[model samples]
Target: MTILIGCAHGTRDEQGQETIHRLVEDIRTALPGKEVREAYVDVHGPFVADVVAEVAAEESCSAVVVPLLLAGGYHVYHDIGEAVKDRADVVAAPALGPDPRLIDIVMDRIREAHIPDTATLILAAAGSSDPRSQADTEAAAEMLRARWSGPVRIGYAAGIHPTVDDAVADARANGEDFEVAVASFLLAPGFFQKRLTESGADHVTEPLAPHPRLVEIVLDRYRDAGGS
Candidate 1:
């Protein structure tokens, strides 16, 4: 059987850790006989390189690394890419965002916050210097805009201009009478989510993990990379 390695950018937050762990467990449950494991690209281990190396050494087993990240960035292109580059038995899948189903989860979060119809929505993401990552985030914002009636904007928690605070501030200045709501485009609760909450928006939506749809997305990505 092929192995599915769910690799996430590790977090220091305990709840964040639990959320990611639960996500991996759900993936395992979804694919009963397949071997599923967890690895990280940053902040903690088992790091992606080590995990891939170990899996590649095993007999009769190929591995697919599915990034739990919302978008492809430095970690995906450099870290995960480097880990699997030399190994014929290992391949890496795309990051999880820019998917319509994820937008569905974001919309649900916005509704749960009871955001007003007049509220301006800001899609908040953990930014990256990589142009590909920025493009992925923009695609996600466009997806959200298609379903949302209100105006949609993009903001970052770090790494690029127009921070969440700046986005919230601009929304308030341009549409003073309208409420500003931030829809977190993050995967789990952690530093980035906290930044969104503190970005001065009238409301902030929750992160988009610990959901069944996410598990489905992971499975699809694994299959797309030729994993069994």
Candidate 2:
């Protein structure tokens, strides 16, 4: 049987871990009778290598690993890719990002934050050092700009230039009426989400996870991967 492995960039936050597990549970619930398991790429246990090895050992047990990340970078092209590379039974799915539906969620969260049209919108992502991740984020920001008429800017939480605080500060400095609001590009809450709240933006939206649409995205990735 082929199992669904929901692999995420793990977090040290206890609640973050719980939220991730809950998301995985929801994924399992969505695809009833399918065995969905959880693993991490960093910060916590059940690492991808071990998980894939375990599944590969079971006779005829194939698996699909769906990345819980919103963007592709080192984790996607290297870490997770390396874990499943030599194993034919393990087919790794694409990252969950650069999707229109995710932009929908960001807009939803922005509206939920109650920011007006005149305000400056900031697309805040937990950044990566990889240039590819930056390109991916820029593409996402372009998608967001397509929907919002006001100025949109990209900010990072870590490992990249223009931190969230700097972005928020710049937006605030634009003019007297500048109302800076941030649309979180993160999948789930953790250290970076907390940083966003402290970034001094007038308003900040919640993370993308704990939403039904994300579960749909994960399943879509899994199905798209096709069983081995």
Candidate 3:
């Protein structure tokens, strides 16, 4: 069996756990024949290494560790990659960010949130200490800014530059009654999402969950990875 592992940067919130579980179920439904497992990098149960070891031991199968993260960061390189190191049967796929489809998703969120050109939009990601992660978020923000026709700022919930509060403050200082619409650049609702909401932003968009388009993206990645 081909084991498709949905790896999340785990959260302490129970609601976050539920959201990831739901996504895993949707992923399984998308790839019916494949066995799916949800694992976390930290702050929750079933670390990626343990999950890989458990599944590889039981099934002697090829494992695909798909990060539910927004960009290539420490978790992608160190944690998830390390998890698959001892397991010859496992391969780690790219993080679920920076894909062209994600641009479309961001546009969708903007439209759904009814953000105006006057609105100072913040693409708030669960930031990383990794510079690459911040850069990726900026790249994604640039893509969105191209199509958005508005001031789109890249902000982080934690870790690095122009944090949510800073984004809001900067926009406010710019002298417009900016509508702070949050495009959650996260795969699931977690502490970051909660922080974004509590950050007193004017509006918040939903996380990129198991939307149909996202399911298609996951399946496409599996195919691209040479999965059957």
Candidate 4:
């Protein structure tokens, strides 16, 4: 069986870490008898390189490192890619984002938040310096806009503008007089998700975590990499 290594950008929040771990467990449940291991790229132990090294040493097992990130960033492209560089048996999978099922989950979370139809949505994400990452986020915004008739804007948590607060302020200043809502594009309840609350929006949706679609995406990524 091919070993699936679930890699994520770790968080300091206890629940955030637990969320990733639980997601990995869910993957294990979905793929019984396959070794599913959890790993972190930052802010935690059990790094990707170590996991890849250990799994590569195992007998008769190929490893696939699937990132739990939303887009291709430094961590996914550089950190993860470098981990399994020389390992013949290990493959790095693409980051999960800009997928239809994920968009469905985002819509579900927005509906659950009771965001009114007339509201302006700010799709807030943890920013990345990588151009590809920003492009992926822009693509996600376009996808959301296709389903939502109201105004939809993209905002960053750390690296880029307009920030969430700025997006909210822009919405308020608009002549349409729409109610402002923030769609948290984060994967879990971590520091970045918490920043959404301070965005001054009328409503903020919950982060996408432990969703069944996430498991599907993980599996898809692994499969796309030709991992058994």
Candidate 5:
């Protein structure tokens, strides 16, 4: 059977690590009798390249590296891409975002935060220098806007323009009468999540993992890349 490598941008936060581990376990449970493993593109390891090389060496075994990241960026195009590019038996799947179900999770988080309809919403992501990543984030914001009647804006935790702090400040300035809520576009708790919490918004939603829809997305990505 083909192996499913659930690769994530690793984190130092223990809870973040646990959250990602749980996601891999869920994928394993969802695809019984198949080999499922976890790898990382940064912070910690077994790193993606090492994992992919190992899988490639195994006879009769091909693998799909499904990014647990919310958007495509350096990690997706460089790290994960380089890991599988040399091996015919290993292929990489697309990042998980710009999907309706993830927007549903973001909306769920917004509602759980008790954010009012009048609140200006900022979709805050861990930014990347990659334009593709920025475009993916913008697409996600558009999706959120369609479902939400309130104003929606985009912000970044790092590596791009209009930091979350700035986004929140701008929203507060433009809509003095309205509260500013940040919808975290992150996958799990970590440094970025902490940054979002301190972004000066009236409220900030939780990260988008530990959700069943995420597991479904990972599975779909794996299958889309030709994983059995």
Candidate 6:
């Protein structure tokens, strides 16, 4: 039997870990016969490599590593790829964020905010030091902007420039009378989301946790990973 491994960035926050754990459970139930497991890339326990090694040894099966992350950042390229190396059995799926369905989540957040046309929208990501990661974030932002009517700007909490504050400032400079609605492009409540909130955005939407559609997306990744 092939193992469906859901890999997350991991956080010290117990609540955050619990949320991801629950997501994995949802995926497991979606494929009752498959052996599903969870792992983290950092901070939390059961690292991806360890989980891969454990499942490969136990089931004598290859695995697919589906990132719970939002985009094809460093975790997808360097960390996850390196961890799965030498294990010909493992295949990594696309990041969770760029999935077309994500636009629905983002749109919902915006609509839920009751954001006014006068308000400028700021899509905030956790941000990565990796240029490729930022590029992916920008790509998502562009997709969102194309569909959104209001002024939208892409910003990060850490890594690259134009942080949440910077995005707000840019919007204000553009004479947007910026409300700076923060559309958190994260999967769960974590440090980055908290920091973005504290950064003084006028409005901040919660992360995309416990979303029913997300469960469907995860299952698709698992099946596409070659799970039977």
Candidate models: Cα lDDT each: 0.93, 0.90, 0.80, 0.90, 0.93, 0.81
Instruction: List candidate 6 segments past 4 Å from native.
Output: none
Q: Write the per-residue lDDT of candidate 6 for residues 60-170, one digit (tens) a residue.
A: 688888888888778888778887788878888877767768878877877787776666778888888877778778888888888877788888888778898788777
Instruction: Show the lowest summed lDDT stretch of 10 residues, model 1.
Output: 171-180
Kindly report which residue stretches of model 2 are placed more than 4 angstroms away from their true locations once superposed. none
How much lDDT does candidate 1 score?
Answer: 0.93
TM-score for every candidate vs. truth?
0.98, 0.96, 0.92, 0.97, 0.98, 0.93
Q: In model 3, which range of ten residues has the least summed lDDT? A: 218-227
The superposed Cα distance between candidate 1 and the true structure at residue 108, in angstroms, equals: 1.1
Tens-digit lDDT track for model 5 on 1-120? Answer: 689999999999999999999999999999999999899999989999999989988889999999999989899999999999979889999999779999999989998999999888
Error of 3 at 136 (Å): 1.5
Model 5 misplaced regions, further than 4 Å: none
Q: Report the poorest 10 consecutive residues by lDDT, candidate 6.
A: 52-61
Question: Whose lDDT is higher: candidate 3's or candidate 4's?
Answer: 4
Better of 4 and 5 by TM-score: 5
Q: How many backbone clashes does candidate 4 have?
A: 0
Per-residue lDDT of model 1, residues 1-228, tens digit only: 689999999999999999999999999999999999999999999999999999988999899999999999899999999999979999999998779989989988888899987789999999999999999999999998888888999999998988999999998888566888999999999999999989988899999988888998999999999997
- Give the Cα RMSD of candidate 3: 1.7
lDDT of 6 at 65: 89
Candidates 1 and 3, the one with greater lDDT: 1
